[model samples]
Target: MKISAGMIVWSFCLAMAAGFTRSKPDIGVPVALAYFKTNAEVFASATGELQQSIDKLDDDPASVIKARLALKNTRLQYKKIAFFLEYFFKSAALIYNSAPKYEIEEPYMEYREPTGFQVIESLLYEAHPATKKLELLQQADVVTSSAKDLNALLYGFTANDKQLLESIQLELVRVITLSITGFDAPLLKTGIAESEMSLRALQTVLQPFREKATKTGVEVANYLSGGIAWLHQHPDFDSFDRLHFLTNYALPLQRSLQVFIKELQLQLNTTHVLNYEAGDLFNPAFLNLIAFLGADSSAQWQIGLGRRLFFDPGLSGNNKISCATCHQPEKHFTDGLTTSNAFDGHSHVPRNAPSLFYSAFQYRQFWDGKAESLQSQVKTVLFNVQEMNADSLALVKHLQQDTTYSKLMGAASPIDQIARCIAAYVRSLNPRSSRFDDYIQGKGPALSEDEIKGFNLFMGQAQCGTCHFAPLFNGLTPPLYDRTEFEVPGITRTDDLLHPVADTDMGRYPLFPMDYYKQAFKTPTVRNTAATAPYMHNGAFKTLEAVIEFYNQGGAAGLKLPIPNQTLSPLPLHLTPNEAASIVSFIHTLDDAEPTGLFIKKSNQ
Candidate 1:
């Protein structure tokens, strides 16, 4: 009755095979399986070999080179396996579980159908495999027993041949850790509806092909049916209300599939497929059905909306400044200024403009946690006199006149529609193709020694991950989508001209009225920290070293700012000047190239 990991995996595989029984399996599945099997076996063998090498090192320490090589190989193998596993889990779940079925078919129900396996597969192939590879690399560790072993490990890690492992490891861990909630019960539950919806959407897309694309489509449908059957049979199935279930699991799965399809297209160089017009994937009659099921929310729409709003000057006051002005796309969606210039231009905004890349996973919105939702944050920026300076009514009125806005907003109330569209877009801004991403995916040789050292320090002595957390690398408070908690870091008024204020800025408490939230700010993403300068509230520091030194000394030394309960612990990083520079270099590697012309395009009247 007790299922081992192997048994669990086997069962899942069988279920998958059974799901596709009516037709041939999609090529992606087999390719993924082959890759998974090969990597798993290689890793297992590599681990054994590494253990033997370690044993040999006991007798002859000079054999550290051999042990280091074995370790590196084992690490590389593990990276390959882990990346594929994540891909498989995401892809399979999309193909088999991302849909919704009403208990009773209602005449009034309007549903949006999901995207199909072909679409998902296409997207998956398009994704830069490097993104996943970099994530895996980030999670890897280089073991050393003594000075001799340390030297050997460093030598091997820095070797030209081993560059792949180093780079892949750095990027892999960064992406993977931020991609999913690791074994967190509540977070998992929260993700369920989205996942299920994604699966269901994929099913809808595949439904038409079931009779035509016999092999791939039928196979996908079968797996989906099995997953649905399993869900119905589960004892805890009825615990959640329908809405909760759909939002948490079903939708997320659909989203994942959409994302996967984009990845596939990227990998296969099938950009044409992605550019296919709406209603082309399914029959004309089914188009309405798809819309009713909410299945037409393609990755393009999601990602484009985020990018659009991100660059819209209308979102801010004066029609001159926009999110992009502060969070420059070329600089990895960070302004590269220490602190951002507010919309008014005369006053400086407290805190540096955090990178918008991979911000969806963050728990809170601002440094002081002023806004509760991403939507709220957007709204705040629109209305804040010093920031955007736009009245919500005026902004809504302006958007209501736009034809494209009409399409994106659909039938919802204007404000709600706009917010959701923008949020949908923001959520799609996850970064994937950094040097670190490549390393995580398996092509290795992406990062340098200094970068690797910084990564280790971040996870180890620096304790940066404790606050930044995984995957998204932002403050992710529990209870999915409950808005993030804020912290007051007691930033000082340094000699920096940007934030020359002598007093502290009261952060969240002013907005929320909670005693504990006084001066509390949201944790920003570190995905492109190197490009976002003037760190912290008031943007006092100009460089990464200055920020590191501030953290090492712990809080503005002589500042009269009140220390909040959640302030970071003093970390005398004890990093030498070179080590500090290495950490900075590593942070710079987090940048992803700016999104191209589409993001930069002005709105068509």
Candidate 2:
């Protein structure tokens, strides 16, 4: 009498497939909400059954297999409505699941807890059978509750037309970028199948638009259908052509859908999450910071005043020092030193000076991630004894005496205004173009063949993109750059090639002592890495080759260091010499933007 979890999911998918593509007679908020509520119960039901299957697991091989299949089915069911779920009800979506190689933090949560589907998937898909059965049960319970919450949210949800369209567009992005890139199903490699289901759901969403603009709608539908069919044909995700998918399919679809939106006369809505123009994929507006700042933020008079303060030595203890002392713009805002010389010149700064280019784009700042924003990071450098070694009050007094600074900066203390201006200036350094970015935006010849190959390896075999992620090539996980991600990469003190010095830096642990974060540090952007090295938080490697080798050997695990929770896989990547070279070539293309002169002044000048 009991229905299997697979049966439950299949039935729902079949129902969705049957009715979803029919071009629902009515196309409005109430109808969309109604359609969602009608189908929402199925998602919760499948998840509950999945939890039960997981709880029933023990020594039996059959039971373990059953649990795994149920997990897969439950995942597919969620994919059915992932777009709408993630866009409107993000808070509830977190409880359900998230992308891999990243940690998420919710605003109201007391403390960060590793709960959700991916955590369960990791345990289920482990090489060895589940050892911690109790932990699996707990996670399954959380999934069940999260699903129930999602259904409740759906019942109360009232999405406007613009919001609905925005969700559809964002979903397409998540599909090709995150889903197709094999980000969501890291352990299972089920991205191909999951993407198919997601695309099928996408087809249903577009059916309503077909009523308004038949030709544009048909074009979008063809792209979606073709993309889904392509995914099915190329089942082997390891060899999947992500570039082709992004450019030929996903990019075209985005443009077509934009036309459809215009034809329908729906007001163009923008979101801070993915405010990119469908005209190009590499647009900087894709970045949350760029979206928040807008195109005109850089030209603000406050930012202009901040630029002068950055090069002025008044912010430092001695009039001889300035923000540019260590952060040279010509060197991509880095000093081109392993550890920069301190304001006193005798001592060295504790950490390597980071690039200001795209520095303000992240959710947090600094290698330790102690500073919450670009302004706070500036505050730390200005006051830290090893750096500027200046007092805020004294600096304010000194800046106030400067007639130009006092006149340009408003009523706020010169120091505070300077920090804000500096922050704005940093944000203005955001890069919208790179050879690799150009390639993604459909200029295929922008990157060399080897560099393109290397990019493929980085995303797939090299495991670099899993942490670095796309676009930013940093720890800000896509679909939503809401929280920052830090990892215990176990970077040694030096790249000795042999007898490498062990990394003793207790990253993030000083702030909150969690076992996993012991020696964990923030993952900075690899964008200008070829220029920004010495690499890692400690400046261990002098060259990109050495850095690649360190990761190839498997981070702390490869070094035989005792980091139980090292996020990086210790297993050797088995990358050939050419593969590594190609990766370096790809990284080389990340340094595309030229240095703007405003932040590039020499001390003598």
Candidate 3:
């Protein structure tokens, strides 16, 4: 009795199912695992066969079309196998790793039932028998050369909704045609191949019940158009930092895609929403949103608000001081005094108000790095008895009554929203196009000989950029918001006319409670460092030269300021005074021409 191909396929499927069931240790393991393992083997075999056919075609022109068809099939089979493997791995991983106990309240995973290992094992075994038949079909699809036969094979893959496989088939055809035609083909075979690939891939990925072709085509077209537009807008694509762009765009795109996939999953009652939109995936608008969200105009508003909040004496107990009394923008956002003069008139704050420029990049705020975020620091300054003696709730209420603040806080959450907005504005205060920016951007003439020498010293011998970093020249990590390392350089204990505080502030230790953070402070941006006077956590240094010299000698002698975990180096800088001065000159080059609207006076009531 001869076995028909259809009967053989059915029998092989049964065997695969049996294999799946036996392999699973429990009933809960997916049967898809069996299918994936079998498909991987089939794909591997097809790839091997296709390579042989390609070698034969290179030696024989008559067989080119036949070889190309075989290659297409091989590619398609491999892609289908690869796609399923990816799906299986991702799904299996999710099942194996349950949500953390603390994250039980998370909205997305809250409803998922506890999956048992036994149940998983049973499902795994049930899917095993079908694997053999699928593998055979995949192999057959790869070696076929007849256009009708190839189309039929392709249709089957699409019917299974394996879009990535279809796309791979299209890509293989395009490449094979290009190789044969030498870029001068009259028919532009590659274009036809691409169109077919797109159509098939889109069809496979879209919902089985929907008008797959039309809807998928529209989505693909839109994605392509958006990509083209983005490319046009950013013509110097090679110059733009790829990692930086990707890092900036990744979060927003991930969030958007997750939301989209969730919506589709709900509509289809299937877990594989990404598979449907696989061929038409990108986030053009999210990328565009980056620029507007971090622009100078926004920064201006933030800086102005910071200034207003800084100077508003009403926040203080005596209504005689504000943040600006210490951190004056005119003094590069620092009071000229060594230590900040607080609201109690004669009481001096423990540390100086560092310059606000490029501070948005720092991990922690304040000279002691007591606040983990800018918002926290703002709150501290507003509520501290020694500074602004205002209650946060009362401050919010007071601001709500003011027409100016009321208008600014319109429809926004009074406290958190306002704090975030102010932070947003501050983060946008990136003063690019400086001499250093010009130098980095290839405008070589922007920096003078001394300044250029200074830049080299800072990055090399001086090792400033190691802490300050590039572009923003602050504590910002290369492409993300990882906190900068804090350092403690011992300052001399002083007895003053006002509030005499501890000689050593213990910087970030009190807030972080980490041993390493003791006496550590966030590294301030070097941009506009020249203008901000009286440096150091205690505001002990009076000049850039003084600060540079202090670092040159490696903090205070025998001060036991532990080797900062994130220090640029353990070795002393050992810079000559002349080199130090050169670095100072380079630091001076960071000052930006003051922008308008940053210093607008409040309307006289």
Candidate 4:
């Protein structure tokens, strides 16, 4: 009558499948708390079994397979409560499952080694798991501790209907952006199954609310059912139709959930970067653009002043250069240079002047991410010796002399105010009027067959969507859009893939002073990429084709460059020329129509 670990897990699954064998109908916060507690126990149990298997590595040769199975089951259990755990207790979630890379906390300079399930997963899937036995055991212990800690935290955990619904929505986004991309499960490629489990958990969480809101509930349930079925049908990682999965299942589910929440009369109390009122993910209004700026009516008034200053050459040390000189409005806010002209007009700036469109959406500004905000970025540019090199106090005095400027300023305008105003104008640049935007919003003509294929390849095989993400097509991660990501792609000094030498520019490394951050640059948006040529932080590639080829060659590492800390995968993507061209065509679809000076017009009024 002794029960094996497999039997225990099977029994737990059976209990979960039977709705935890509760005689009463599942509904409300009490049911949710109960489900959470029970699931936590199962997770803890699975982790314990995994630890036991790891401990038995030397005694039993089959323990490696057993440990792997146990780890998978443990992760599956974690998925059941991932919505609650990840949303409510993000710090604890990190302990349970953080990225397998070493992280360094900025400013504080505290270096943290990788830990949790991803660490253990990498070890278990390795060719020499036995050689890493000690490390595996240590990670297993960490997972066990984390699982128990999660259980401890769940003791008094309580969530209202709105919170639960919001968590579910965020979970859906995570599935789309992170889970199915094999981000967390890079070695195992178990994300597809994990995503299905995540959806099932969401369904269970919504079961109580569904009874309260019938019509919207039915729509939500159907979408969930269809999405889950689709995931179950297509479990393969690389070949999965991500674009179809996103458009047909995930996007619709998000829309339905919004309606379902409204029908239940529950409004989110949290302040998120995303505009909850936006009905579609790719809708232009999907993100709250002003949320980042902390803008007000007065700030809106400053945009006109900002636009004037932006076009004024007097702000610079010399009387001849303006922001518009480099960020020409007609050229999609890029000067069509490999790097912009310096203050001397003879020399070039160190990096390319990226397109201003959608720049406001990013969490960080600048290629090296040295500037924390748009205002900060503007201030740096105004003072950089190689760039504007303007004395702030003098610039302020010079601007105040103009009667029109004095009228706009309302008596006094500080240097900080000037930077703020310019930042406001820059923030107003996002028009989201691309053909891709129109297509995603369902208000424009269908994309070409090549464009669709390119999009699929981008999202699926090319692994572009894994970093750029959708809607914004930037490295600002979705669900929480709080953190912008920087990666060391190991960009080469030249476009020569065969004799690639790593770019000499030390990118974020100089600021952070970490080997890991060497050549780490912000992942800029591909929104108007076709318009803004000569890409990468250092403008190493002169054309979009070269940029695509660089990626296709799997960055510098694939070209046999010694970029030990490169974040991009070294293995080649094996994309055909037609495939690469198609991706480029899809990128062209992201080009916004000419800016009509939307903010300038409003400011003039």
Candidate 5:
């Protein structure tokens, strides 16, 4: 039964008057087992239904529809245990929730085609697999068998109070970041229903942790209950004010849960993608540290050494080029050119420099999503002949020659340390408090009415939020900033949006050769869009308005580019000129009033 808002408040107050306590009930291993068992049962049932439907499909068109519809029920059942499964049984969870695309298998996993609820959904609904319907049923059988295997594997599943608390909070963040945002059920629009089911699961796991109805328990109970109730009330997909949802309900829910856990002195047992013990999703420290995952150190002194190397021309062969030659800080780290200058200076470099601010927020670096880490990105630029034209050995020798460099940079493998340090310096460049951030944080006057309306549109009909997600407004999806996302937003090589030709650059295809990744590039942060110009991989769009219009017209696909599987949904946004301007206004809010760095001139660097 759903707890009443008034009853929760009353309970909280009465319990508060009575005071709080930290003692726990016996940890519920059985609850975890039951959770796993229920998922196995549900997946098996769904698989059976699908098999039966597939059998009837030879004669009845309705059977295909029935099979398609049946998957939703199965999905909801899995959703109830989605976080629980993904938290522990991540490899097993992939059989249900993997993306409907080809993927290179991870080291431990076998190479296989995409097979999941989404793949099944697409086959039945979108792909219209006429001759392959039987093959689809075979996949269903495999999924069912895997679920049974997973059930057996989970026999030893256990959780202490700390893991339980961590899971719930992490799951709560997932609800706001992924669930309510429609990230999970992108095809079926079952995200809201799934979230409700997840909430029910949350209520179940958390029921045992009432701390004997003390104030701490009441607070946790009230917030979780209230969040669930709010979701129940706002069931519709289209009209849900997600911005309001995040600020009013979700933020409060996160805070209260933290307080509940802290008050109970729940010791953290493990760290997640945020890599911190607490894994506090909304904390600034968590936000800042996303980029600097593995290094010998991220000391300010190292960062200072990096800054020095950044401007020092000795890193280049002719003692003329430095990183700052192209990545000028005042210009948001871009050189304000269509493309950057080559080492020879007569010709332009291949691609425009992406802004350094918030660049490290995601694991994948570079416009093409080539480099896996920031240090590797530095290495790419250093040796790329077209860029800095410096060698690791030569740079280290140069570093040894400078007394100041030796003093600042540790007397070790100087070039490698310098590269890591430079990456650290780049990591230090963070987003300044923008108007949009301020408005979301409750300083309402930070954004004008038009900008506010624009934000709503961005999160709503414009489909910006669907791709460029919140907080960092990049592809590192919320709760865990681990996997970076890539998109093929069919764009032309030239600035002429009307006479479109597919941008010849095969973006992520070089790394992961697949049809979907053919023209797909990394989703870069749109934070300083107002400042950084000549957008796209080829630097085609010179103005933010032009970029907005490109998206408004559904990218190059809308411009009649023959892109079959262009990842950007090729549907015209139908934004009015005023509406487009409003979106631009909202984008402007992402710009720092001044770039947050020690500004240096390109000539000096």
Candidate 6:
């Protein structure tokens, strides 16, 4: 029988259907295991095709197109298995499709260069693909080798039913935050199709559990089918109604999956950043703060104690400045200055004082992301000669002199106690009581038409959601929020849009000493931008309008500034003035509603 191409495609689809529809299992493990085995083989086969296509690349223009097509197919095949592969083999998965940028690991501080599909995608889509042939061949080799090693790792792997469900839930989060946002497929813009493929694979693995789930099972199936169909109908990248998709399909799907899991009596492991108990994505409790910062039973007491320390000027060398000096509560933890005043009171700090609200959510701290944790950030600010300029011994003794702090200090080291207490106060700042949060949770007034439009623009056309992910709207990437991302937006020295000159702040480069890290600063949360003014690391843009205009013109690159490594796309957003104002209005909706006791004023000394 001579196998025709159409027959080969049909056979492949048939085999996949058989794998999914085979005798329904009692539990999810067997189904997951079978799906993994089958998809792993498919991924390996697609990888082989990619390798062959890459080998055939030459002066022939058709060869390049064939290679690109092969690469895209291989990516789609890999998407079919991304859920399990990412959940089980996270480290290896990093090599497969992490961002095509140099990553610096914290603490140990190891620099890992980019590899895999994204790098290949960038190479293939570049203006001159022929020039990148050598590098493309190398990246292809890395991907193929990594895929084979992963297959080896999956040979006899076993996972519990609860873990499989948990992985599925996380995959939904990934699809919402990463896949639909074109995060991994920057050049290809194939995130929507990839999301559909991922959902199809998820549906296959979920069949056994879905069947057992009864009524809840029906809800889950409808959401899966509906979401897939929605993606199919709206294939255009720029005009895709992300807001509608998220509210109607993605959010409902997530809720239904939880219901299905509960109905099946499956327990989820709560060690991840995503809180399994949260009902919706924008719930105040959406992220597991406890997972981000280890559980503190005494957080309430620590927060109160920390508030006093935060307001005490004795913590500084001159006994005149406190944490509140730079981070004023009334101003939303920012001083409303272009840059904060230094210890000398005559000079200014190099960077703006970013709001402490939602500060505890990210893995890295500071503009350069040099501090590894909130505690480290507290310590660094306290001891820095240019900032607080605190004398460690004197500060400790000063705190120990206070009866209240002395009691809290007890047997703990004074410095450690101070750091912990102040850090605790900062951690307690995130209230997540914004109007947007309320609307997302189905409680607040419906967002205005303009506000809704602005949000859709932010998520899709504006491309803000790609970096400032939803829920937290911070650089902490979702699914597994282990790493914080930094980007170089090529900010200018001042708010002058017409005569823009690239700022001389080397940003993360001074710490990492890498070219790519140049001008790369940690992406901060825009949740309270309405309160925190003078945006960016240097606070060059005074008004929110100026900042929006700067971005509208595509950062410094759009301003014709020299920024070879600007990570922000240089393409103009072309936002009308009205559209810009609408976005600003939408951002205002993110201001936290008055919490009962968010701010604690200075004590009478």
Which lDDT values do the candidates have, in the order given?
Answer: 0.46, 0.73, 0.46, 0.80, 0.72, 0.82
Model 1: per-residue Cα lDDT over 1-605, one tens digit each: 88799998888789888863354334333333444454456555665665565455432435545644554454334434433333323332222222211111111223323322212222222224223322222212111111112112223221121222222222222222221221111112222232233234334333433445444344445555544443444323113222222223333333333333333332221121121222111111211211211123445665566567667777554668776677665666667776778776777876677766656544346666545456777667767777778766767766777666666545556665556566666655664556654553334464666677666555334445545654345665321212343555556667442343433666766765655455556777677677667677667677778777666555542233345343443324456677667667767766654554523534541
lDDT of 2 by residue, 1-605 (tens): 99999998998899888865454333656556755665567788888988888888887888888988888888888888788778887777767775333443421113445667787877776655568688789888888877776656755445567778777777876775677666766666777788888888777766666765488888888888888888788877666766666667777887788777777777455555565454434556556565432222555766776677778787788777888878877788888888889877888877788787767667668887787777778887888888888976777788668777765446546666667777877777776567777667655465677877877777766778777877788877665565567777878778874776677888788876767667777778889888888877766689999989988887767788776677776667778899999989989888856745544566533
- In terms of lDDT, the best-performing candidate is 6
Per residue, candidate 3 scores C-alpha lDDT tens digits across 1-605 of 99899998898899898864343132111223344445446655654664455444332444445444554454445334333332333343223222211111111213333331212212222223233333323333333222112222223232222322332322222222221111111111122232233233323433232333354334434443343343234433112222222223322223333344344332221221123232111211211112221223245555456556555766566667665666565676677787777666777877777777666545556655556566676667767887777766666776877776764567556665455555554554445545554544345355677776676566545556545655455654322223354554444454221322335567766865665555666667778778777676677667888778666655543233434332223346678888898889888877865766443333321
Ten residues in a row with the worst lDDT in model 3? 100-109
Against the true structure, candidate 4 has what lDDT? 0.80
- Model 6 residue runs over 4 Å out of place are 1-26, 40-70, 107-110, 144-153, 270-272, 293-295, 392-402, 552-554, 557-562, 571-579, 600-605
Model 6 collision count:
0
Which one wins by TM-score: 2 or 3?
2
lDDT of 5 at 238: 53
Q: What is the C-alpha RMSD of each candidate to the true structure, in Å?
A: 19.9, 9.6, 19.5, 9.8, 8.9, 9.4
Model 5 agreement with the true structure over 1-605: per-residue lDDT tens digits:
88999998998888778855344554644675576577668767776776677656653567767776777777887877777777777788788887666543321124546787877776665435556777677768767777666667666655667776777777876776777656656556666777788878887777766746878678667766776787788777655656666666667666666766676688563543453333234444555464334433478878887888888888987788888888888888887888888989799877777788888777678876777778888888888889888976677778778876765456456667777879878877775567766666665465677776677667666678767876677877666565677777888887677677677888778886777778877788889878988787778889988888888898887787788778665667788999889889889988866643466565543
Q: For candidate 4, report its TM-score.
A: 0.87
Positional deviation of 446 in candidate 4, in angstroms?
1.7
Query: All candidates' TM-scores?
Result: 0.48, 0.84, 0.48, 0.87, 0.83, 0.87
Error of 4 at 168 (Å): 1.2
Candidate 3 displacement at residue 446 in angstroms:
2.5
What value does the lDDT take at residue 254 in candidate 4? 85
Higher-lDDT candidate of 2 and 4:
4
Residue runs of model 2 more than 4 Å from their true location after superposition:
1-70, 99-110, 141-157, 268-270, 276-281, 288-300, 391-412, 442-444, 496-502, 513-517, 595-599
